[model samples]
Target: MPESRRRKAAVQKKRAQENVEIEKNRELKGSPRWWAPLMVGLMLLGLIIVVTAYVTGGNYPIGFDNGNYNLFLGFGVMLVGFLMTMGWK
Candidate 1:
């Protein structure tokens, strides 16, 4: 009931709340289950896109096949996406 006691109680409660928040953040960061599957799926999707581009010839001009270039570009984009999904690791 004293003013000093009330202030101390408030401070203690704030500290407890901060501790809980910190723990929650740690649990989230430490979990990799979601990241692993997401990155893999992205990488696979990129591969599919690149393959499709190659098979379609990417509408290259001069009667020459340029699908490989498209494939490489798709792969590059996929790599970046994968890395980003995996936290740039």
Candidate 2:
């Protein structure tokens, strides 16, 4: 191969690698639109559970009381997070 051709190929390869890295960084850098809310909701739910448990002295079956509701909420949040993470091109 010619010297110029080899140099061009190397530059192209480097550019491709840089593009891929940028894309990956864009993918991983943020919590995404829905992710932030989902994470915040989950965290708040955890906080509520902890506070309630401490206040009630573990007398109430908090987890059992709203088990399905919380599960559904989590599923919905997870679905949103998944969709957001996918990041449509």
Best by TM-score: 1
Off by over 4 Å in 2: 1-31, 61-89
The TM-scores of all predictions, comma-separated, are 0.43, 0.42
Sliding window of 10 residues with minimal summed lDDT for model 2: 59-68
- lDDT tens digits by residue: candidate 2, 1-89: 45788888999999999999999988777544676566556556655655555566554334555445544554555565456545433
- Residue pairs with clashing backbones, model 1: none
Top candidate (lDDT): 1
| Shift in Å, residue 80, candidate 1 | 2.4
lDDT comparing candidate 2 with the true structure = 0.61
lDDT for each of the candidates? 0.70, 0.61
